[model samples]
Target: MPEMTRIVLAARPEGAPGPESFRIEQAPMPEPGPGMVLLRTIWLSLDPYMRGRMDAAKSYAAPVEVGATMEGGGVAEVLASQAPGFAPGDVVVGPTGWASHAVVPAEALRRIDPAAAPLSTALGVLGMPGLTAWVGLDHIAGAKAGETIVVSAATGAVGSLASQLARRRGLRVIGVAGGAEKCAYAVETLGCDACLDHRAPGGAAALSEAIGAAAPDGVDIYFENVGGRTLEAVLPRMNLHGRIALCGMIAWFSGKGAAEPMTLPAVWRMILTRRLRVQGFLVFDHFDRLPAFLAEVAPLVRSGEIVWRESVAEGLEAAPGAFLRLLDGGNFGKQLVRVGHDPAGT
Candidate 1:
């Protein structure tokens, strides 16, 4: 009878979460019930959205109650199955939460071909973040060649792919990131026409000037991920009839900027007068587009036409600290926690 290690929400945070917010404990390994598969988590994905799940507030999803396992998606190896079409040694991807082992329904798991790509990729580029960039840019924003587009979090999981895909489509891509290194990666590697560092002095005002210089034609489309000063900077520069795909607002996820004052009338007037098309979307609402997304982007990934980066913490104990660092703009790319060994090998 092997035991499993899990990290649970110990307490909710006031602004930013810390180590005291999480608790680690051991429990009996979960057993699969009928129509379920028992799995050992391989790679655990940490995204900005998880911050919202920590607060006891109403949102698209239920908040993770204190003392419960933190919710997350991961790639895992099947250890046993009571479900059809699954068996020991099968690698799968699903919502495995913050535990070393999970007993999940077969319907909730999707088997991945280890030969196709790295198994860890199932939690990154070929997974939710990849699909998010695709749907937001292609389906939602309807990005066009010859158009000017700006992507925030430019070197992040979703934004990196969005910047690359937009560049490939011949868009004049402008990127907004935290530091000089990430900004350089966005321009040199992701093929962005320009990249702005929001952390530079003079804050949003300086960023706005940079955006104006980069997109003298005015922004044709904005792939919005961070919604604080970045949004303020981009809104005034939006071209008439410009489209905005409202993705995650990571800046406000931890309630850091929620209390800031903004003139709603001014924002409303800009939208009304400019005829700006703003659409907010959730990735979960667009699962039907996954196959199409894979069909188009998978080849680019395989051929090295599209590249990705990952910042990984070595073990489960590192998750809490890594997650805290992620909220503070410390992660370079897709942030992951490696819980169990990858049988697929590096």
Candidate 2:
């Protein structure tokens, strides 16, 4: 095995992840064990959910143990295979972590078509983020035609997809993002009816007024993200029996959920008086429906009906910066880091 440099958890941060909490170290290429595959990572994905995994507090998954690799999603080309289902050169999606390479059971990952779309999209639009918005919108929110849906982080991975999907389903769409440029992209590229800047002064009031006008009947679906002020504003505007799909919270991720938690008392009032539904979701919980989702979303990617965007960082050394950009909502769409070029890149 050759020497490979990998990022490991040096220390857990008290708030947002900092460079000191992660360190790059020399590690030996891991040989595949029985029923496992050795993978050479090509693209690493940085997502806001990673903030939860960095802490020791018990949650949906175990925290990254000290001295261990920080967990993340990545696309890898098979280097060696001890499993029958996969072959060398195959690209797959896995929890390859913030590392140059890894060894894991092939069952944990789904083999992907590098030709279907950019392999990077396997971590973005046609992948987890796509599935997230689909399941949350379709199953949880029950998004319907003619109804109005409001989404935050509207230019982001999940939010962007949710906006597009809801529109295709015939729903009127509005998006909330960090700045005027992002708002413009959401309305122009992502095909939302309107977009509001969360960074604008009196942004919350602006969002409320925008929703009030766009949804004179009241908002039918709230694609919740950026919890604090955004939620506070969206709460009172929810229509009778509207739906709330909890997505990313880039707001809380920026300050480590330390600034203030947004509790929706007004929303509860709407729930009681209007019979609204608020659901929190994780994409993994809906893995059962992924094949159906991919069936629909994959071709959209190839035909370019569903566009994908990515900010690709240079190498394994660039993971820290990618992680920072994602949490700060500095990225436009999906956040990605290239550990090295894929054979496909050539």
Candidate 3:
């Protein structure tokens, strides 16, 4: 009998998850039912939002219950289909969680053409993260040419695309990343006007000064990802009537440093005084834009006009470690876990 391997959440951590939080086990392979397809996961996307799912806290999405398979999105190869328009060997992208195989409803899966791009990219640059950067920048932030924008986590999955897109729109982009190397990549590769190392010794004050120098006219837009110190640094620098696309707050995902209260009154005052338009968004709410996003970005990706990067963990068992590394600022780009062999060779 064939077996299915999965990683489950063993425990929720108080701060910064560890390997002990996950457990790996094998079970009988799942069978597809009516309107469903049995898929072999090819690429599992590891994102900062997964950290929030591990906790039992109330949020826009429900938490992954203890002992349940850790939730995630992935690209998979269809092994068997019980639905129309899908067949064996079809590659699709959907929520596959942390498992070697899954039985997903056909409605939840979108078939992808491997000939158009790498299979793994269906989980990264061409998938949810790509859609996120597009919707956040164009729809939410309403970015304009000649505007000064600051992108936090500028070298990571979403930020990388956001930075590049901003530059293409002729915006002056100042990127905030963790290290000198990532900062350099933001400017040189992502085409940011300037990049700041948020991990630099002096904390938020130093980062704020750098942002000031980068955008002497004040920040017209802020693509917020890491929200702790980076948010603190960019708030006071925002130009009057600036826009903020509130995305992930990875810095507080593990609950670390969250006990230290931010001065809400001060932040509220800045928002009111500057007339900032801050909008918190979930990419899931904007799937209607996927076709348009693909129409614009797919060509750029194929033409090599828009580039992306990934940090992949080779197997299912490596997911827990890789996820912890991601929270610790260890991943270089979009983090993914490759659990099954790709029929379309890389």
Candidate 4:
């Protein structure tokens, strides 16, 4: 029998995940049975939500059990098919885990048109990350044109799209990121009105000053991706009846900053005084919006009007290390693992 390489959860980490927490192994090559398709993974997406899945704590989704293949989204090519409406050589995007190949039900896969955009984009924009940005900004935040919007982790996959979407809608967008280079990408490439480097020496104080300068009238919508200090800084600048789309919180996900106590009383007071509406969004629950999101965002991406970036790590063995870097703010853009060679030359 042929073999396939996979990465599995070797153990749970006490704090931030290390290379020791994951194990690389070879398994029997998966074969399609009835109503199934054999997929060869080309690109795998590493997202912040996977951090929550690594822990044993309860969440909206089940955790990846110790010794099980780590769950993930991937772009793949169908090698064989036994189901209707799907055929061999079709490229697809779905939950294929951290493996070189996958045997998934045909119903789980969504075919991607290679001519429409880059195949790797199925794991970034035009896929889950794009869907997340759109749903949060449109549905949860109810963003309006001319409103001032703040996007944290603004150079990341979700944040990049979120900030761009707001800018396209005629909103004044200010982005908060870790370093000067990312801040530049947010402003120059992603078209944010202004971007602040939160990793500077003065940290949150510097961010406050930048936000004040960028959105002098006060922020009307906040797309929150990093919760810790960034959230604290944005609260004081919020306008009356401001709306916040509380997305991923990569700051405390690894337990690195878990010891720091957040002063919630001040936050609550601001919520009361500003009459803020903060809503936490889960992309899994909003899959129904994928069609609508892709319809609107795809043309813009294809025409180069909306730009996105990706940081790719080669091979399945790099998956664990790449994911750890993603959790630590080391990734420059959307973190993707090139598990296998894409036939489309992506």
Candidate 5:
């Protein structure tokens, strides 16, 4: 019998998760029961959403129980299959968690074509994050050509795609990021019209000034990602009827369950005066659009028009630290852990 390595939730974090929140454990390799498949994790994705799972909070998804594996999505290779359609050595992507292997229902996994794109991408640009960008900006926000659009976390998995997608639509896109490297990538590679460093001194005032200078015509659409100071900076500059797609509130997440103070009165006044159309979206709600999204984005990615960067942490042992870095804005792009070898050589 093979032994498997896994990370389990040792404690629920009240504030930002620390090393004590998780524990490493050894388990016997999982076996596939009827209608199920056994998988070996190849690439484990470390995303900000996983932070919510580390706490016992009300969310769209259930929190990881104490003493259980930390929940996450990963690209895996089928080691054995008791399910009808799946077979040994097939590549699939699903929620297999922070483990070297998993035994899951066949219905829960989606087969990935190695020929379409790199297998790691099933967790990044060509997968959930990319779909999030497309659905939020195109379907929810309904961004149009010649519009001035702003997206925070511009170099992140979802923000990168949203910023570029907005550009593809002939929108003048301004990206809000934390540092010079990311800001430069947004402008030079992602084709954003301008990129603002939110981590710069003077904070909100600096961001507001940059937005005013870049989008002097006023923001027609705002892809809301980091919500604290970035939201405050964007509020006053919104054009009449400007649309906001509320994707993630990373700043608030840093405070854990604690509510961060906001200029609600000012925000409401601007919303009323600007007639802002704001909608919060979850990517799973639009999973049905996967085929459509893949058809449109896959080609661009293959042609190098939709380029992306990755910051990989080697081994399952590194997942927790890598994830912490992701939440702290330390990662430059998509954060993934190479937990095991990719059989496809991608």
Candidate 6:
């Protein structure tokens, strides 16, 4: 039997997650059964969404049980297979969790070429994060050419990709992110028409000013990611017939189980007066759009028009501490854990 490494959540965290919240364990290698594949993980994607999975409480998806392997998305190399079509050494992406190896059915994973993009990207820009941006901004928010768009976490994985995609669509793009460095990256590197620093004093006002200066008309699409005071500010500035695509609420993840009063009155007034269409969505809701999405986004990425960033945690053990830091915005790009090397690079 093949022995492997894995991380399991030891406890539910009260505040920010600590290293102690998880434990690394050795497990027997799983054997592929009939119509199944044995995968050896290469990369683990640590995202803000994983925090929601740790809780027993209900959300868009089911939570990970206490002793189970931490639920996660990962890229893996098919080491063995009993199913048809898959060969040993084919790369695939799936919800393989924090384990070093996983036994899954052949139908559950899709083979991806490493040369199409970095194999790591299957967990990042060209993967769920990019899909999140593409589907949320274009499909859900209906971002159109010549319209104005704004996204919080502007330089991050989904936000950066969304901003650049918005610009390419001819929409005036306004990016909002923490720190001046990230804001500058969003504006200068990512080609956003304007970027506002959310950490600055009177951040909301500055954002309003920046959006006013950039679009002057108003935001037509608001890709809601951070969603606290950020939502409060963006709600009032939406143009008539604008759309708000609610993606994630990172601000709420840190203060887990703490319910804050929502800006419902403003949300309603804006929707009514300005005719805003604010819709909350889970990314999987549009999985059917994946093929179409890949067709549209892949070319842009290949041409170097779109940039993807990764904040990689070194090993399986680092996932817990890294996850905590991710909630604090301590991570710069797509927060991920590298369980193994990119064999493609070697």
Q: List residue ranges in candidate 6 displaced over 4 A.
A: 203-206, 256-263
- Which digits, one per residue and each the tens of the lDDT, describe model 1 over residues 49-83? 88888999969999999999999999999999999
Candidate 5 lDDT over residue span 241-296, tens digit each: 99999999998895742443576788898999999989999999999999999999
Candidate numbers, best lDDT first, in rank order: 3, 1, 5, 4, 2, 6
**TM agreement with the true structure for every prediction:** 0.98, 0.95, 0.98, 0.97, 0.98, 0.93
lDDT of 6 by residue, 1-346 (tens): 6598888878887766777778889988889999999988889998888887777788878888887899888999999999999989899998788988898888889899888888888777888888899988877998889888888998888898888888888888889888888988898889998888767777556666656776688888999998766676777788888899998888767574244335567667778999878888887877788888889888877888788788888888788888888887888888888888778882
Q: What does candidate 3's lDDT look like per residue over 1-346, in tens digits?
A: 9999999999998787899999999989999999999999999999999898888896889999999999999999999999999999999999999999999999999999999999988877888999999999999999999999999999999999999999999999999999999999998998999999989988888989989998999999999998888899999899999999998888767766563246789889999999999999999999999999999999999999999999999999999999999998899989999999988886
Whole-model Cα lDDT of every candidate shown, in order:
0.92, 0.84, 0.93, 0.90, 0.92, 0.83
Q: Which 10-residue window in model 5 sums to the lowest lDDT?
A: 254-263
Identify the runs in model 4 with alpha carbons over 4 angstroms from their true place: none
* lDDT of candidate model 4 versus the reference: 0.90
lDDT of 1: 0.92
lDDT of 2 by residue, 178-266 (tens): 88899889889999998877667775677677767867788889999778778766777887777888876667764644454655676
Ten-residue region with minimum lDDT total, candidate 4: 254-263
Which stretch of 10 consecutive residues in model 3 shows the poorest summed lDDT?
A: 253-262
Clashing pairs in 5: none
Q: Is candidate 1 or candidate 4 better by TM-score?
A: 1
**Clash count list over all predictions:** 0, 0, 0, 0, 0, 0
Better of 4 and 6 by lDDT: 4
